[model samples]
Target: MVRQETDVTLRRCTECRGYAYGGGPACAVCRDLVDGLVEGAWAVFLRQWDTVAGGDQERALAEMVAAEPDRHDWRIVDAAFDRLVCPDCGGRLARGPVGCPACDLAHGFRYAAIETDRPGVPPGNEHAIRVNVSVVRRPQVTSESEVLVRRLLLPLLLAGFLPTTEAAQRMSALMKKSPPGRRAQLVEQAVEGLAEEFSRTRRAARAAASSPTSPDTPAATRHRSARGRPR
Candidate 1:
């Protein structure tokens, strides 16, 4: 009888408790799932594992983490930190690739990495910043309603040029407090004054062209325009 070689699929990391895909020595899923949610992510995974696999799995996970605290990479803060809380389900996400399959099908994580110029620097000099991010399953935008609404409303909201209801009322009150003329009447008066000045300028220019060239033409009648216009 000839001995034949048997093909076998290797399991995922037994220590990290990842599903086996027969690709690597460690949990390939865990290694690949670098969304940046440091230790809190591992805690969530362990907690879930504990709930599903019972006390034994929990003990194993605890021991593994205790041996290597950096596995989770979650900074143990003295105070409560701001976490992404689901508005619909009120489920808290632990910074990395995670999802509630019941509420959502997306499995994602969030985390930060130290991309240092000098990796061998001392702890004091190692510059690292916490960057928060989200990775979600792409959702379909079925309508152009959002774009339409934004385009219509954004201009009105910005640049205090247009009067809102309250603003209109305020302006009305201010005009009422002013002495004598109505706002429209005042605007009309200003317009009439501008028309008169423009007519006078044209008449003067015509007269100057018809008349002989003089040494002084009284500097072309230096009449000003209006407020918000150059003098």
Candidate 2:
């Protein structure tokens, strides 16, 4: 059989755990789903957070974060997303095509080379069966996304707006929440708060380091400066 020779790759959705197969961006359905989530993200986040945090939302959230400082991931709750279906075979695509029946059928070679006997062949004939190699192409979006996010985080890390790289990561992941106007305001407030705290810590450290040293530091400095009573 002649191969189609079309190059395509599959992408996996992070939020919905769905799969989309194509050459460029993900399928239209997935884009629409994530776009909807991004449009009214702040409200959605608050609603989801409130439900997840139960009573006394702020306190609950604080306690939860304190329990696991590096584990407060955003979750899209109370919604179901449809998995992407392959355009060619009308079958659901798998995330990166591991053990996917449709993917195996569409792109997997599914066979190994083997020797077979032919009718009327010589007594010791050892001919091998012809085999075709098929490679399933998977999207490289994850690594690309990581590099892009790292580039975006560099400025925040240098500017002291974010105290650590991990915090920058979390903030970047949650960037869709605040709208443009609100995003600017929130960023300003956050930077101001962090800057103030950083400045305060530095001042405290300097004061502690420069504090009096048993009333001997000044005397030693003077003795060193004197010329032994002009002798």
Error of 2 at 140 (Å): 24
| RMSD to true structure for each model, in Å | 28.0, 27.4
In terms of lDDT, model 2 sits at 0.34
- In model 1, how large is the Cα lDDT of residue 42? 44
What lDDT tens digits, residue by residue, belong to model 2 across residues 55-158? Answer: 45634543343334223221111111012344444553322334556544432222221223333223212111111001111333234343333323222222
User: Residue-wise lDDT of candidate 1 within 1-231, one digit each (tens)?
Assistant: 111121212223355542222111133443333222234444556565554334555545544533343333323210011223344456442322234442242111222322222232223221121211111111112122222222222112111112245643654464455454454344334333433454465467658765534334445753446689964
TM-score of each: 0.17, 0.24
TM-score, predicted candidate 1 vs. hidden true structure: 0.17
Index of the highest-TM-score prediction: 2
Task: State each model's CA lDDT, in order.
Answer: 0.31, 0.34
Residue 225 in candidate 1, Cα distance off native in Å: 88
